[model samples]
Target: MDAGTRNRLRARLVSLRDELLTQGSMNIPPARTDVVSTPDDDEAPLTHMTQAIASNRNRERADRLEQIRDALALVDEDPEQFGLCEVCEEPIKPRRLELMPWVVLCVACQEKHEHEHRSPGSRKHLGDFQ
Candidate 1:
């Protein structure tokens, strides 16, 4: 890619990474509250469960933010590697790069990777799932 295009992609990736970080940091731990009713109360249990679920989701978001940061770092370190498939070492399509500047796989290699590594019991029947 040209220098201008690479610069644009880098800027985009950096902005995305910053946004993810900001959003992830905002997902703080759920506050604990005193239960006024019996422990067996439906609302209390449901509220606690919902808070737990939100905590888990926040953790996952933090992990994803880290991944995005790493991807941005890679792009900064080597622009040439930005649009190349990590699995097949092929040039990723420009449109794909435009859509996801930090992607590390070409379309074909991404498809293969998804098919081969998808979780067990996951449906893989469609060709366009990816």
Candidate 2:
């Protein structure tokens, strides 16, 4: 890739990393409350559960942000590696790169990775990253 393209992609990845960090703010523990017979009191448990779920989502987003940071490091070390498939060593499609600048695999390789490695009844494979 040219210098301009590398710079643009690097800028974009940095922007995304910042945006994700801002969005994935640490979930605050629910505040303690006094005994009260109100709708808010009745919904406290559900609210806490929602907060827990949001916290988990935020943690997942944080992990992706780490991946983006790693990709940025790789970009700095070798801009020529950008947009090239790690598995096939071919140029990844422009649209795919546009959509996911941190991607390290082409669509074909990604699909294959998912099919071969992803478990049917398990959480996402955090290792087979983009």
Candidate 3:
């Protein structure tokens, strides 16, 4: 990649790292809470279920934030490596990097990976999904 492009990607990586840190910090507090107390009433069950769902979502977000942080660290250590796909060892497209600075996979490898590992009930529509 050109020097200018590398500089732009580095700036974006730094921004993404900061955002991930902020989000991960926010998720940590709620994640430490004790499980909701079991209740005899139906309303309590619904509330508990909602809370559980929220907790799961937070956990997932936190995990993603960690991945983003790691990716940023990799970029800082060796910006050249950021241009390669983590899974297939192929060069990532410049446009892809421009669009998602933290991405670690090329378009073809990413699509293949997602196709093989995506959940059964996951959204299949391109527009509705990432």
**What is the TM-score of each predicted model, taking all chains together?**
0.73, 0.73, 0.67
2 versus 3: better lDDT goes to: 2
- Per-residue error (Å), model 1, residue 56: 4.6
Candidate 1 similarity to native, TM-score = 0.73
Tens digits of per-residue lDDT for model 1, 31-79: 3444563454656667677778877877877776675676677777876
Clashing pairs in 2: none
- Candidate 1 Cα misplacement greater than 4 A, ranges: 26-32, 35-40, 124-130
List per-prediction Cα lDDT, in the order shown: 0.72, 0.80, 0.71
List, residue by residue over 1-130, the lDDT tens digit for candidate 3.
7768878887887777677667553222332245785454756666666777778877876777776677777767887786789888888888777777768887777777777898998756433334
Which is better, 1 or 3, measured by TM-score?
A: 1
TM-score of 3: 0.67
lDDT of 3 at 129: 36
For all candidates, the clash counts are 0, 0, 0
- TM for candidate 2 is 0.73
